[model samples]
Target chain A: SQTIHQWPATLVQPVGSPLSLECTVEGTSNPNLYWYRQAAGRGLQLLFYSVGIGQISSEVPQNLSASRPQDRQFILSSKKLLLSDSGFYLCAWSPRAGATNEKLFFGSGTQLSVL
Target chain B: GESVGLHLPTLSVQEGDNSIINCAYSNSASDYFIWYKQESGKGPQFIIDIRSNMDKRQGQRVTVLLNKTVKHLSLQIAATQPGDSAVYFCAENIAQRGSNYKLTFGKGTLLTVNP
Candidate 1:
């Protein structure tokens, strides 16, 4: 079985601080990786996705950025965090083959609180 | 712009009752749809999915129905339980350039099951 691990499970960052969240998948290789954020009582927003190492597509312009440093390792980073950057961040992956109809499997998620 | 939206923001149901969550999308070219469930502070879990070629798909106790004619999708839970309390989101897969695709999510509907 495949599993995704994300950390820290919860984070508290001051405004204008740097941010880095790591996510990695086990038991799968060359999977499609994605980063999504959800505001409290709101929906999930796609931030970035990657098809392979060093390849990332940004879904929206924001204060955050994502990078795929390895085949199964993805990182979300921010040089300077904003108050609005606080939210629950999630990492997900889907099979690369027959990707059109594939469902995404998500990690436990990381909750970031900016103060 | 094209997006997915939900009909209700919240719903409350008694335990053992059936629950239905509705979603509508504006993009006619979307060919794939998915349902996800998210508990508080956790990543959204894949519940079920349906493609444009199929109108309905069933999982353990969940069912997803897609109506391409009206661009509406629904998720039905049989004998809803307290453990089923969570936010439900509907997502549509929009094809981008070439074989790439993006999953667009709707504002989730919070479902509360009372014991």
Candidate 2:
């Protein structure tokens, strides 16, 4: 089974501070990676998705960005934080092309609380 | 681009009782549908999924039913537990949408299992 890892189970950042959240997958190669944010009491909002290394797509333009540096590594970053950015950050991966990508497996997640 | 939605914003069921949550989609071409569970301050977890060809798919204590004719989907938990209390989201991916297989998620239903 594939496993996902995300850093800092929870984070508290002040407005305008730089932020970086990392996500990595083990036992899977070239998996599609996604970054999502769920506001308090809201549904998962797609932020970014990456299909391959050095490639990324933004679903919703905001203060956040995503990058895939390695085959199994995806990173979410922000030059400056916003109070509205406070929410639950999630990392998910699906099997890449021609693979048995049935469902998305998620990481434990990182709760970001911008103060 | 068609969208997916849920019938209810929230649902409450007693522990050990069966819980049912409903969702709706506008795209008839969607081939894959998935249900995700997200706990407080956590990321969405993969619960189960069903394809359009099958009416049902079962997993540990959970089942997913896809009513493609009516464009409706549901998740059934045989014996809902406190651990089942969370926001449930339905996502759809239609083959026609493109190779990226971008998923469109519903607003989601908050399922609260009462003890």
Candidate 3:
């Protein structure tokens, strides 16, 4: 069985501070990874996705970025965080084959509060 | 510019009753759909999915119905229980250029099953 792990279940960061959130998957290789953010009472917004190492695609212009350092390790980072960057960040993965219509498995998520 | 939207923001039902959640989408090019359940402070979990070629699919006690003619989708839960209380979201997969695809999610409907 495949499982995803996300760190820092809850985070409190000051404005203009650097941020890093890590996610990793086990039991799978070369899977598609994605990062999403959900604001309070709002729907999810896709931040970035990677089909392979060093192949990140941004869905929207934002203050954050994502990287795939290894086959199953993905990281979300920001050089300087803003108050508007506060939200619940999620990491998800899907099988690379026939990924266009595959369902995604998600991690527990990281709730970041920027004050 | 296309997006997914829900018909209701909240629903309350008695335990052991059936529950139905509705969603609407504006993108006709979407070929895949999914339903997800999210508890507070946790990531969304996949509940069910259906493709454009299929009108309905069933899993466990849940059913997903896709009406491509009206671009409407629905999720039905039989004998809803208190554990079924959560936010339900519908997502659509739109094919992008090349082999890329993107999922657009709806603002979730909060379901509360009373015991």
Please tell me which predicted candidate would have the highest lDDT against the true structure: 3
Question: Which digits, one per residue and each the tens of the lDDT, describe model 1 over residues A1-115?
Answer: 9999999999999999999999999999889999999888888888999989999999889999999989999999999999999999999998875546678899999999999
**B81, model 2: CA deviation in Å?**
2.7
Q: Which portions of model 2 show Cα errors greater than 4 Å?
A: A99-101, B96-99
Ranking by DockQ: 3, 1, 2
List pairs with backbone clashes in candidate 3.
none
- Chain B superposition TM-score per model: 0.96, 0.93, 0.96
Tell me how far the alpha carbon of residue A114 in candidate 3 is from the true structure, in angstroms, after superposition: 0.7
Please list the C-alpha lDDT of all candidates, in the order they appear. Answer: 0.91, 0.86, 0.93
Number of the top-ranking candidate, with TM-score as the measure: 3
lDDT of 2 by residue, A23-107 (tens): 9999977788999887777777788989899999898779888889899999999999999999988898887777332677888
Two-chain DockQ for each candidate model: 0.68, 0.58, 0.71
lDDT of 2 at B84: 85
- Per candidate, the number of residue pairs that clash is 0, 0, 0
What lDDT score goes with residue B64 in model 3? 98
Model 1's alpha-carbon lDDT is 0.91
